[model samples]
Target: MAVKVKKIERKKMPFLERIYIFYIIAGMARTFRHFIRNLLNTKNIEFLEYPEQKPEDITPRYRGLHRLTKYESGELKCVACDMCATACPAKCIYIEACEVEGSKEKAPKVFNIDLLECVFCGLCVEACPKDAIRMDSGIFTKVEGKREDFISDINELSSRKRGDF
Candidate 1:
């Protein structure tokens, strides 16, 4: 079946509208208004000194940095199933499985998540059958220098404690 297409009349743009003069002026005016308001009331402005000042608004469900959970015996909860890596949409998670010395289960010898590439979607946490990985560190990922600094290794992830957050 052939679909009937509707022909709509196009409005002719005026010289000022075509040039976006009014839109630009409106934007500039809004910017200047905010600037003037801020300038006049500097004390009213609230700026959180991040890293030093923890945001009070961070809810319980806030997905922050990634961390690996440990068992009561201090061993990592991860079983090297590669579920998290498989579920990651960004393909940021990397895991090298090693056979545990005394157990039949495998453990991650080199579990690493590149924070730079991570979307912080919490999919890895959900996909894990062991509940090994979590994004509830409450500490926001921050890297100042070196791209390699953003990669969180197994040791770093496991070392993160609940109190640290």
Candidate 2:
């Protein structure tokens, strides 16, 4: 049975919520803490110049930018079971599976994820049963002028994971 939800009447916040001094104080405190820590231990902070000095040693479990995985045999690892597509809250992932000879499951013939459509919420990564998709590889692909170029294939995504980028 469906329950009807009443329309909520939103009210203006109190003067504190509106002015938000508490939030400012908290942020300032955090910033001051970081500032003091950095001042004390100059080499302790992990910072990169970005685009110029990228972090060379990211943790293995670090949640990286994004990646579509592949098997070591040069075959696509994604089974195209639609888990990623379904799991995506943005509904950005699309898959068209095709059968291979002697294979019980179907592989993606046309697998596309719209970066413009993706929130990078990591739902797709968590949904992958085979660990065939991961965003923890420490590699980030650049978006191009052509929207179609952002629709990366398993092969292209896999090649980057293959180490010779």
Candidate 3:
């Protein structure tokens, strides 16, 4: 048996439609009309003075700045198990563990996180067994002059308070 195939036909647009200038002009005119209408109506003008005024509410699930939690005894809760550093996908975390003077538990002598390298995936926080690390401080990350400024030290991370959003 022989199969017959039909040729597909495509409708060609008019010369005016083929040249996109007319469509472009029509779109621009529509945009201009909306702009004029919005400009005339004061209620349609939606502008916020940022920097001077921050948004009143931030989402509760927003992962902002990282903070190291402390124990009730005023000591750092991190046992320096390297779990967070190991779990970091970006390898931004760096930790140096040292034996505590009198305690059997090891403490982090130096803990640093390179903000530039961090992807902010919250994996480090999830890997921490002692609940030492958290990203709920609500502190906004600031622009720094030097690369070294982006590397947050153990003290800075531990000092962060749960800020009001």
Candidate 4:
């Protein structure tokens, strides 16, 4: 099949439009207008003194940070089943299993979650059969400092309290 090529003629732009002075001025005017409106209507703007005043809108279902729960006997609830690691889509969870001292049960010798790679999907919590892993600590994940700081290990995950943001 032969294809027909059709060319459309474009109209030449005027000097003012070509230079873009009008567009720049218009953008500046819009910015100034918004700035003036926002400045004058400051009462509508809400500000929180963060770290000092937490927002009240954080819902109960909000998944903040990962934490490892403990049993009443002061033992880790995780049996090192590796279900959370397997269920992680980002592959950020790492678990190394070790046999419990006197029992046939196994436990994690090294359980680490890289916060940088974690998608915070809460799949780890759902995958855990023992209900060891939870994302309901309410401690916000603040990204700061070195790469090594972002990795949450067994001790760190186990020790996180509810208010330790």
How many residue pairs in model 3 have overlapping backbones?
0
The window of 10 residues in a row where model 3 has the poorest summed lDDT is 48-57
**What is candidate 4's local distance difference test score?**
0.91
| Candidate 3 CA-lDDT value | 0.90
Model 2 TM-score is 0.61
Sort by TM-score, best first: what order?
Answer: 1, 4, 3, 2
Residues 1-165, candidate 3: write the lDDT tens digits: 999999999999888889998889999999999989998997968776764666677786778879899988989999999999999999999999999988899999999999999998999999999999999987756678999999999999999987777
Query: lDDT of each prediction vs. the true structure?
Result: 0.89, 0.77, 0.90, 0.91
lDDT for position 73 in model 2: 75
Using lDDT as the measure, the top candidate is: 4
Number of backbone-clashing residue pairs for each candidate, in the order shown = 0, 0, 0, 0
Off by over 4 Å in 3: 1-51
Worst 10 residues of 2 by lDDT: 156-165
Which window of ten consecutive residues has the lowest lDDT sum in model 1?
Answer: 156-165
Which candidate comes out best when scored by TM-score?
1
lDDT of 1 by residue, 3-69 (tens): 9999999999888889998899999999999999999999999999887888888778889888889
lDDT of 2 by residue, 1-165 (tens): 999999999998999999999999999999999889999999878777775666676556656556677666767778889998999999988889899889798888887777777888898899899888877656554748898887767666565552222
